[model samples]
Target: MIASMWSLLAERRDFFAQLALEHLAISGVAIAVALVLGGLFGGLMAEHQRMAKPSLALVNFLYTIPSISLLGFLIPFSGVGNVTAVITLTMYALLPMVRATYTGLSNIDPTLIEAARGMGSTDGQTMRRVKLPLALPYVMSGIRSMATMTIALAGIASFIGAGGLGVAIYRGITTNNAAMTMDGSLLTALLALLVDMVLGFVERRVGMRGTEGRATNRRMAATFAAVVVVGALVGVVRALAPATSPAIRVATKPMTEQYVMGYMLKDLIEHDSGLTVELTEGVGGGTSNIEPAMESGEFDIYPEYTGTAWNAVLKKEGAYSEGLFDQLRQEYADRLGFEWLGMYGFNDTYGLVVRREVAERYGISSYSDLAHVAGQLRLGAEYDFFEREDGYRALCDDYGMSFGKTMDLDIGLKYQALAEGQIDAMVVFTTDGQLSTSDAVVLVDDRRFFSSYLCGNVVRSQVLEEHPELRQILSKLDDTITDEDMSAMNHAVEGEGREPEDVAREFLERKGLLQ
Candidate 1:
């Protein structure tokens, strides 16, 4: 595994290097911003003793939120990618910095403050001459700690469509590539250690300076200023950078098929049209996160399912039908200013996947049949499935199912649980790779509880107006991918360890859609 990791790193050094730079830039900007704002706030808290309690309580509460949860909370406000990442990182970095400044300033000896005042030092002068110099070491300690922590936490940024080493980690896990995962994990650890060591050196110097002459203090201050200035410059340049031509910004959910399809859109659009495609794959929270982003024009294009777009994005209820496809498109256009185009000829609808042995024992071949035996079986499903409008409760209600027990499992773990006899049944998608080979039965949705989810591209209408050719380019995928085709491609990545792009390109080539 170590050998494999080394080879993968060497092979993808450029990719890893870009990710490392992105990781550094994100952490650097976040820490720099936190340092400025948190130091100001914390210093104020120290000066006004009454404000300290409430201020500390607020920061403590924010700091206590789980990283993933915090990112989810920030998505609607900050949108996704580096903006969301930097915001979340800055929030988490604030507590350490604020607390450190407050602690340092509050710990100053009263006699020293009095002595400075008696020596004709004004309040500001006393703070600069006595309080601040004495507090230097503590502030430096906080910066050091904040920098190290931010870099490590930055890995979570990739989960929300940000660029970083975390992308490698997330992609590696999704693709089942152990070497890629190792590469990302090891590099992140090394980065944290490296930053810690460098900061430790700076901290020791700050402590050693120890309230030196005014000239010496100014020099130390300049050193800190330089670091913050550089980080801020990096962020400004990135934010202001403009593309020479309008690029198609595409986003995709955190699923194998979506990743493959995202690349397919990129490949075909770039091949025929004189346009560049910027693809952000594996967006966290899928439609929930990406929908708002699309509505806000943060994303110009993304692949979405008809049913998921209806139930999840539109927040509609009741069973969907082929008749509603036009209604769905119309609602999207009139309400969201989006276009639903390029319906890929594959129905990746939901299903009730039962253990073959259990199904055979219960004589169950359909949802209605399962309902009769449900009281004796346990069902395990992904957590969000229970929360989704078209998910667990609705399906069960439609089929009159009453399982003996229900377990909320991770999406990745439900299949394993079913195979291990920990769950007699679990929800699945028609294009699930395991369905192609597993000795399990996908009970018929006799009641049509689940809607058919024909895959398609959801595009910003404004973009389509600018690039009318994109409509033709995107429609090339219509009637192209079949159920078996999508399942095989998904299995190629998740099961056979092939890259999603490689699988997508191969399928496109076979279909004569690409050269």
Candidate 2:
């Protein structure tokens, strides 16, 4: 176990370093942006009595919304990655700073303002000299609060593939591996604590400048300048470092195919060619990821589901045909500037899964059969399904079936909940490895409510045009995975407590997909 832990850490050293850097970058940027915006907004509100209540109320409301839900909502507009994470963190940081600024400015001595006015100081001068100076401490306090909030929020950004300590934590939780969870949580807490201490020290120093000597201020300034210079030099060197070799940039989505295939392709590509492979994991699921990354040239290659591309992306809702996958591939290339790298050997279709005993008792075998017994079963589904135009809600409506209860759970936790009898049924991916181990029966979609979810790679047109050999390499990976293979691989991570990357590598080696 110790050896395995060490190996995992060593393998992910660079990835975790990148994650830490990204976390810091996001938190720093968000705090800075929030400080500026909040100060301005607070100043305006303080100046106008009429605007105070409404402004505070609005910011306060935003502060109350859960950070994860806000991040998810922002995905469509900002897409995935650092931008979305930074923006969400910024918004979260805003309220504290705004309130602090308002309080500090409003509580400033009215006598000081009057004295400044008597001394012929204009409103602007009075504000600059009297209001700002007195409010500096409060503003710093707000900044401190924002910094704390941003650091905490940045960890959750990993869910959207923003990359940070949260990535490790989420991966651990999904795979049910306690050690990874502890490692990630510890690192994240330490990062937050260190940042808080640094910021607190800066705040204290700044607040004490009024009582301190000019010599002390001068020394502090010089120290800050020296640190900045050294940091800049280090950044320059890192940026100038040459690319060692050809690298494959694979784009993937969070918690889905991108999570699975990213690891699979990374080890395979690196081992086979002895070249670096960069993975750009995106935020959303299949329907949200594939085309946009391909069109924007943000990703070189990624896994895509044929059914999702057709029904969700193309808006072609109809019966599935044998040649539909090929037809969609050609259409996507012609219309969307992407190349459909031939299919991988698995179908990750939607399955309506229930406890085996329940299924046996009810004699439920298909969707049509589900209608008769629907009144007795409760349903658990993903949040997206509830909101989707043609998702589980619509499916139930179409079948004229009503569930006894409904609940929403994260995709990773759904299986555990089902096994624990939290819900009678759940909509799961057909290729999920847990089905074989758990006493769950996947009801046949005989009515064909779901579209084909055949897994495959989709490359940006430019990537396809630039590296023709990539097509050949990826094509060779086609029809390589099976239902059992997926189940086994999932079990290695989600069941047997193995890391996702390890499971991915082991599968590739077993299938001879890796050299």
Cα lDDT of model 1 by residue, 1-515, tens digit: 98889988898899899999999988988988999999999999999999999999999999999998989888878899899899999999999999999999999999999999998999999988799889988888888888888898899988899998898987776665778878998999899999989888766665554466546757978997998789778878987998666799999987789999999999999998889999998887788888899988889999999998888888999878778999999999998999988888999988888999998888999989989989999998766688899998887787788999999875545666787999999888889765666668888877778898999999999999999999998888999999999999988887787888889899889999997
* Model 2 Cα shift for residue 164 (angstroms): 1.7
Clashing pairs in 2: 345-479, 433-487
Give me the displacement of residue 396 in model 2, in angstroms.
2.4
Each prediction's whole-model lDDT (CA): 0.87, 0.76
Weakest 10 consecutive residues, lDDT, candidate 2? Answer: 282-291
TM-score of each: 0.90, 0.87
Candidate 1 stretches greater than 4 Å from native: 210-242, 356-365, 372-378, 403-410, 416-424, 437-439
| Per-residue alpha-carbon lDDT of candidate 2 for residues 1-515, written as tens digits (9 for 90 to 100) | 56755666677788667767877877888988898999999999889979999999999999899987787688767776778888998889999999999999999888988999999999999998889989988888888777877787788777665777787777666566656666677667778889889878877766665545546867988998899789878988987898887677776654534466788878766766646788765344545644564566555677877777776677776644547877887888788877777577778777798888889999988888888888898899877777655577668877888888889887677878888999988898776756778788888877777766778887777865766667677777788888767767777767676666777777777877876
lDDT of 2: 0.76
The residue pairs found clashing in candidate 1 are none
Question: Pick by lDDT: which candidate is best?
Answer: 1
Worst 10 residues of 1 by lDDT: 205-214
Question: RMSD of model 2, in Å?
Answer: 3.5
